[model samples]
Target: MFKWKRKKKWYRDFVNPVHEFRYAMEFVEETLEEEKTKEDQILILDFILSVIREDLKYDTLTNIFYREKWFDEGLRISLPFPYHYYDEKGNMLSIYEDKAEVKKVDLAKECVLVFPWHRGRMRDNIKNIGRNEFQYDKFNHKAYYFSPVNICFVYNGMHSITAGIGFKKGYIEAAEYDVTKLFEHVYTDGLYWYNRHNNQKLEDDLLDFRIGVIYEISKIKHHIEKDAT
Candidate 1:
């Protein structure tokens, strides 16, 4: 006679938020793999897009950032079509069914435009926050400096950074840290926040591309079926 043992939840909840996303994506991927025809793929994509649209109704900027849990690449599924994102230097970063690499982007080089989803409110705030007292000194702000990535993670004064960039103020004040002890966690968390914003934009673009793909595939599928008939 043996007693049943319950499985431990990693997040200490019924579902691990991180793996839940990975599992959902894995299911989508497996389903797509089993489809034998373009019509089948189109139908699957359309249904998935519909559900995603409904889910997005409640999704916000904060929620979107959490989607990049642990910065795992397995969370991304291939797009039906190629999608392009441009860097500050106008270099094209293309993503498609095969490419899933996340590039290390330079923030000062217009990476802000790469993810324009969070610009709505920040744009308005940028205007009202005057530049009269703006200073280039690092003593003015509370921000974490990631020496490995050479990027600053702002704990407060995000709008100040936005304003600095918006007006070309050149730089913001940040205290330099040894960060040797906490480098691993800081780097991972910083990268997670950085990639999540980019991934959110990528995710949105993929959904739109999926719709277009469904439309094109639907017509082609119809033509094929009609010709066979």
Candidate 2:
């Protein structure tokens, strides 16, 4: 007689961290496929929008750069209603339903405005965790973030990450301006930044489109070190 071996659970403590992370991502992939109808095509964007809030078929920004994830001809996700609904006063009603919640329609009579939906899903995703595991704020300052370890620098002046954060955090926005300081990340937009104590405003940079994430996080490590000195 042969002795049978036990099957180890993937979630068992013995698994490596990297392997766990990869498996978690794969499980997310599998769930997207399961949540489909007979005629709908599944997409990767449907899964890793781990950050964005909408259950949209294709996000506008992602569709522009990563086109394959979206099915529509344009970046807009499919609206919940085939015909636009409005009150007697002509104000549009707010309805952020998924495609499943919507009714089939004859396009000739349908009208709708499918503006981007927002409920700040990213903030809800990582509201609480260990200090080593992060969200955005630290050292009495806030972070401009894209992903973990890809956050703003602790440097006391303006940098690319600051500009991006400034746009998101309400310190700055899309506009034309000139650069007076430099940072590790750059916004392709013509927007600019000013120092913490300065009252002056920057115009914009005509040439600042950047590809790839910039990591001056080594600078963050240095900032932490010098603060302790």
Candidate 3:
């Protein structure tokens, strides 16, 4: 007979104190892994930027998407960048579609400014829950959800890296800096703790890029439809 025993507080009964500690540790470990991944991403971005800075001839910037793999552990993710070009006036050029119409803008000449997207309190709550599953699952059986923070960089044809964050409006502008330095900072900081502890090497991975591009394209298409109205 498969009889389900119903306790007064099913959560409290099933989740023990020791189990809670184990869950907390797991969450901490996962957080460490995520940090390491972010560091690796920064490293790759920096490398690409350095190439851009060194050689001014190569002006086209292509979007890169790294596929996620099981072997990647925490180092697999996507990276996206716009096709960056320059005008005769030393202006940064980028193309974006507005309402089914391709629009070109000179970033350097335009007054357009980008701000970092606010990763709202809801996202923070999700992150906390992902880290503390034991406590979360005890209170509610619902699955945990987390919104990841994306770290981006701006690079010229030569190799240099500039750190920035994405926004709903567009990419935020970061200070011009070296790519290697960015990677070193991330590796030395709290980011790479888990990878170092686990003896893992960061790889160039970009699974998120593939997924995001599709969504972004779809959104652009929708925007175009809206603009035609």
Candidate 4:
């Protein structure tokens, strides 16, 4: 059995498309104030605006990371996080991470179910593996990995990562955010989009924390008014 305790709906302030847009602007503004060169700042701001424009115009807010060249080749890297799988009966079946993969099945003991529906989803993802259907376009599906304090976390694409493991494809292509302290903590199943699917509601802890961190790290001195042009 799975346990899901509902929390107060405090995510309304941070998780909507509008708020996401604001955060992106604030993050870009603060990033501009940093010690980056003039050219780098311009490049970063341009990319940020492009992402925001896409989101506002097309309703396609894909999480993307910055790169020197947006059309460059995709990265090929191993699954960077530990992935745990449990049976329907809540028994730990396997764990995959890094170069060394571990597969274990223990039916005699049961573990607490954090996500009741995740196992079913993983099964579906496994079907998509090795089908040559995956594409990581640099412009569209560029970046999903987050590294805060040097620890890598996947802000998106868990199913694909799990499926890649099942297919034994090491060193998959990926793009990472090479920032430190962008987020202090990466909670379990805390992303707004992920929670939106399961709870039929939005929770903005992940986004909230990120925006807060951006302010803290950057110490932005002046307010950035919304661009009217």
Cα-based lDDT for every prediction: 0.37, 0.26, 0.27, 0.34
Give the per-residue lDDT of model 4 (tens digit) for 7-71.
Answer: 33455544664455456656765776793565566566545434433332122111121223222
Q: What is the lDDT of candidate 4?
A: 0.34
Of 1 and 2, which scores higher on lDDT? 1
Model 2: lDDT of residue 80 = 18
Question: Clashes in candidate 1: how many?
Answer: 2
User: Once model 1 is optimally superposed onto the true structure by TM-score, how far is the C-alpha of residue 121 displaced, in angstroms?
Assistant: 8.3
TM-score of each: 0.27, 0.19, 0.17, 0.23
Candidate with the greatest lDDT versus the true structure: 1
Indicate the residue-level lDDT of 44 in model 2: 34
Best of the two (1, 4) by lDDT: 1
Counting only residues 3 or more apart in sequence or on different chains, how many pairs clash (N, Cα, C under 3 Å) in candidate 4? 7
| Residues forming the 10-long window of minimal summed lDDT in candidate 1 | 184-193
Ranking 3 against 4 by TM-score, winner? 4
Among residues 3 or more apart in sequence or in different chains, the pairs in candidate 4 whose N, CA or C atoms overlap within 3 Å are 75-173, 75-174, 76-171, 76-172, 76-173, 77-171, 77-172
